[model samples]
Target: MNNLNTLIADYFKDSIYLLIENAIDIHNNAINKPNDIYLSGKLMAYVEVLSLLQMQAQAFSIPLESLKLDKFEAEKDLLSSRIISKEEIIKT
Candidate 1:
C-alpha cells in the first residue's frame, strides 16, 4: 500500500511539471505572435491539461488549497491564469 501511494504521488508530481511546461510553451507562442491563428486553440488545450492535473491532484487526496507549495506554486499560478471562463466550462 505504501509503495502504491508513493507511485501515485510521483506520477502526479511528474504530470504537474509536464502540464506546466506545456502551458508555458503555449503561453509563449501566443505572446510571441499576437496575430497567431492558433492561440485560442493552444490555450484551450492547456486548459484541458490543467483540468486533468487538478483531477489527478484530487484523486491523490491532495487539496487544491495546498497547490501553493513552493515547488508547485509556479505551475499552479500559470494554470490558474489560463482558466477557461466559468461559462465555457459549463457549456453543454
Candidate 2:
C-alpha cells in the first residue's frame, strides 16, 4: 500500500509539472502577442486550473515543496516583466 501511494503521488507530481510547463508556454505566447485575447484567456484558465490542483494536493496532504513551483513563478515574473517593458515602449 505504501508503494502504491508513492506511485500515485509521483503520477500527480508529473501531471502538475506538465500543466505548469503548458501554462508557461501559454504565458510566453501571450506576452509576445500582447493583443490576443484568446491566448490571454487561455492562460487565465490554466492559472485557475493550477491553483485548483495545488489546493487539491494540499487537501490530500501531499508535499508541495517537491513541485518546484518557484521555478514556474520565476518564469512567470520574467514574462510579466517583458510585457511591462513592451507596454512602456508603446506608451512612450
Instruction: Estimate every model's Cα lDDT from 0 to 1.
Output: 0.57, 0.63
Clashes, model 2: 0
TM-scores, all models, native as reference? 0.55, 0.66
Best by lDDT: 2
Model 2 lDDT per residue over 30-88, tens place: 88888999987898888778766667667988665765443344334434635323232
Candidate 2 regions exceeding 4 Å error are 57-62, 70-92
Task: Tell me the deviation in Å of residue 62 in model 1.
Answer: 2.5
The digit string of per-residue lDDT tens for model 1 on 1-92 reads 99998887678666655666666667656656667778857766776667666776679887765542223333344444354232222222
lDDT of 2 at 69: 46
Candidate 1 weakest lDDT stretch, 10 residues: 83-92
